[model samples]
Target chain A: MIELAGVTKSFGANRVLAGVDLSVGRGRSLVVIGGSGTGKSVLLKCILGLEAPDAGRITVDGRDAATGDREAFLACFGMLFQGGALFDSLPVWQNVSFRLLRGALKRPRAEAREIAIEKLRRVGLSPDVADKVPAELSGGMQKRVGLARAIAADPQIIFFDEPTTGLDPIMSGVINDLIREIVSEMGATALTITHDMTSVRAIADEVAMLHGGVIRWTGPVAALDASGDPYVDQFIHGRAEGPIAALR
Target chain B: MRLPLSLLAALGAAVLSGLAAVGRVTLFALATFRHMLSPPFYGREFLVALGNVGWLSLPVVGLTAFFTGGALALQIYAGGARFDAQAVVPQIVALGMVRELGPVLVGLMIAARVTSSIAAEIATMKVTEQIDALVTLSTHPMKYLTVPRVLAGIVAVPLLVGLGDIIGIFGGFTVGVQSLGFNPSVYIRNTWDFLEPLDVISSLVKGLAFGFIATLMGCYAGMRSGRGAQGVGRATKASVEGASVLILAANFLLTGVFFSL
Candidate 1:
C-alpha cells in the first residue's frame, strides 16, 4: 500500500498541491482524474521522489519514502513516463532491459535480451522490432514499448503517467486494455493519472479527483457518477457551468 | 537619472547572476569528482565516452596542429630575419607550439565541439525526462552520465596535446626546410636541443586542466538547463562560452605558474 498525507508543494508563489491526502490499497488500480494544471503530475512526481513535497509524509508498505537505501527502494517500482522517455541512443530491446543489463538486478546479456523480447511480445510488438530505435517507432508503438519497459523488471508497483494521452481512440483503447490486463495479471499496485473517460472506465477500480491542488472527490468507479459532490458531477459529466469551472 | 538608475540595476543583476552561476558550477565540479572516485561505476559508459571524446577527436586535432605549426614557422622566420636572427626560428616555433598554442587551441576546439554537444545532448535528455527515468531506474545522473565523460577528458586530452605538439613541430620542420630554404639537419637539431623536459610536461598538465574545465562546464549547464527549445539553446551557448573562456583563463594562469619560475 502507498499513502500520502497532508502533501503540499509550491513553486515560488504558485501552490500546486495543497495538503492532498490520498491512499491506494495493495494491488488496487487508482486513476487520478483532473483538468490541466491541477497538480496531478506533481503528485505522482512527489510519490516517485522526483519532486519532494514541502510538507507531507509518504510511506510505501509502512516505511517512509525518504528512509532506507534509495536504489533498493527504487528497484521495487517501475514507471512509464508520459512522453515515453525512451533513451534515443539505445535500441528498443536495450531500453526495455536497461535495468536488467546492469546493477543489482543484472542478468546475462543474452538472457536479458530474451526477456526484453518476451515483454515486447506481451505488449503486442514483434521480435523484428527489437533492434529498431525509439525514433523509428510511431507514438502509439513508443507507448507500447514504454509499457514493455515498465513491466520488464516484473516490479511489485507500476506507475502509468498519462499512458493514453496522445494515442488515437482505438490505440488508446488497446493501451487501456493492456494496462488493465497487466495490472490484473501481475497483481501489482497500480497508480495512473489521466483525463480520458474511457481510460477511467477501463483501468480504474477506484477513482480520485484532483481540483485546485486538492482531492475534491475520491470513491469507487461505481460511486463516481452518484457521489453527490457538485465538483465530482461537474468534472465527470464535463459540465462547464458547475462548481469546477473550466478556465477561459 | 532614470536611465542611469536602470542601467545600474541591470549591471547589479548581471553581476549577481554571474556569481551564482559560478558557484553552482563549482559545486557541480566537486560532486563530479566525488562520483568519479566512488564505486557502482558503469564501465560500458566510460568506454563509450573514451571513444567519443578521445579517439574520435584525433583527426580534427591533427589538422589544426599541422596548419598552426606551418604558420608559426613562417611567422617566426619572417620576424627573425629583420635582425639576422633567423636561425632562432626552429627553437621559437618548438617552444611556442609545445608550451602554449597546441594545448590552448586544442582545448578551445574541444570547447567548441565536445562541450556544446554534451550540453545539448544532456539538456535534451532532461527536457524529455530521460534523466528522471534514469533516477527511477536507480541510476545517479552524475555517476551514470557526468563522471565518465569528465574522466575521459582528463585522460584523453593529455595524449592529444602530446600528439598535437609533435605534429605541429613536424609542420614547422616541413615549412622551415622545404619552404624557407633552411637546412633540415640544423633546424631539427635546434628544435631538439632547445626544448626542455619541463616544457613538454607543462603542456600535458595544461591539457588535463583544460579538459576538466571544458567537460565540467558542459555537464553543469546541461543539468541545470531550463525547459523548452529555447532553454536547450541557451544551455549549449552558455556551455561553449563558459568552457572556452575558462580554458583560456586557466591557460594564462598555468603559463604563469609553469614558466614564471
Candidate 2:
C-alpha cells in the first residue's frame, strides 16, 4: 500500500499542491482525474520522489517513503511516462533492458536482450523492432515500447502518467486494456493519472478527482457517475458552466 | 524615468539570479563528483559517453587542427620573410600549435559542435519529459546523465589535444616545405628542437579543463531548461555561450599560471 498525508508543494509564490492526502492498496488500480494545472502530475511526482513535498508524510508498505533508502524504494516501482521517453540514441532492446545492464541488476548482454525480447512480446511488439531507434517507431509503437520497458523488471508497483494522451481512440483503448491486464495479472499496485475518461473507465478500479489541490471526490469506478460532488459532476460531463472556471 | 528605474531593477535582479544559478550549478557538480567517486559505477553509460564525446568528435577536431596549422604556417612564413627570418617558421609554428592554437581551437570547435548538440538534445529530452522518465525508473539524473559526459570530456579532450598538436605541426611542416621554399628535414628538426615537455603538458591540461567546462555548461543548462520549444532554444543558446566564454576565460587563466613560473 501507498499513503500520503498532508502533502504540500509550492513553486515560488504559487502553491501547486495544498495538503493533499491519498492512499492506494496493493494489487488495485487508482486513477487520478483532474483538469490541466490542477497538481495531479505534481502529486505523482511527489510519490516518485521526483518532487519533494514541503510538508508531508509518505508511507509505502507501512514504511516512511521519504526517508527510506531511495534505490531500494525505487527498485520496487515501474513507470510509463507521458511521452514514452525512450532514449533516442539507444536501440529498442537496449532501452528496454537499460536497468538490467548495470548495477546490482546487471545481466549478460545476451540474457538482457532475450529478456527485452520477451517483454516486447508481452507488450504486443515484434522482436524485429529491437534494433530500431525510437525515432523510427510510430507514436503508438513508442508507447508500447515504453510499456515493455516499464514491465521489464516485473516491478511490484507501477505508475502511468497520462498514458493515453497522444494516441488515437483505438490505440488508446488498446493501451488501456494492456494496462488493466498487466496490473491484474502481475498483481502490481497501479496508480495512474489521466484526463481520458475512456482510459479511466477501462483501467481504474477506483477513481479520484483532484481539484483545488485536493481530492474532491473518490470512490469505486461505478460510483463516479453518482458521486454527487458538483466538481466531479462538472468535470465528468465536461460542462462549460461549473465551479471550475474554464478561463482560469 | 519609469523605464530607467525598471531597467536598473532588472539588471540588479539579473545579476543576483546569475550568481544564484552559478552557486547551484557548483553544488550540483560537487554532488556529481561525490557520486562518481563512490562505487556502483555505470560502465555501459561511460562507454557510450566515450563514443559520443571522443571517437565521433575526431573528424571535426582533425579537420580544424589540420587547416589551422596549415594557415598558421603560411602567415608565419609571410611575416618572417619581412625580416629575413623565414628559417624560424618551423619553431614558431610548433610553439604556436602546442602552446595556444591547438587547445584553444579544439576547445572552440567542441564548444560549437558538441556543446550545442548536447544542450539541444538534453533540452529536447527535458521538454519531452525524458529526464523525468529516468527519475521514475529509479535512476539519479546526475549519475545516469551528467557524470558520464563530464568524465568523457575530461578523458577525451586531452587525447584530442595531443592529436591536434601532431596534426597541426604536420600541417605547418607541409606548408613550410612545399610552398614556402623551406627544406623538409630542416623544418622537422627545427620543430623537434623548439618543442618542450612543458608546452605539451600545458596544452593537454588546458584541453581537459576546457572539455569539463563545455560539457558541464551544456548539461546544466539543459537540465534546468524550461518546458517548451522556446525554452529548449534558449537553453541551447545559453549552453554554447556559457561554454565558449568559460573556455576562453579558463584558457587565459591557465596560460597565465603556466607561464608565470
Q: Residue-wise lDDT of candidate 2 within B1-261, one digit each (tens)?
A: 999999999999999999997897798789878978986677778888888888998999998998999999999889988999888889999999999999999998888887888889889988888888777666778888888888989999889999999999998888888888888888888899888899999999999998898788888888889889999999999999989988999999999999996
The candidate maximizing TM-score is 1
TM-score of each: 0.97, 0.96
Candidate 1: give the clashing pairs.
Answer: none
DockQ of 1: 0.89
The lDDT, on a scale of 0 to 1, for candidate 1 is 0.93
Residue A178 Cα positional deviation in candidate 1, in Å, after optimal superposition: 0.8
Best by DockQ: 1
Count of backbone clashes, every candidate in sequence:
0, 0
Q: Candidate 1 residues A81-139, lDDT tens each?
A: 89999999899999999999988999999999999999999999999989999999999
Question: Clashing pairs in model 2?
Answer: none
Please provide, for model 1 over B196-253, each residue's C-alpha lDDT reduced to its tens digit, 9 standing for 90 to 100.
Answer: 9999999999999988988888888899899999999999999999999999999999
Categorize the docking of model 2.
Answer: medium
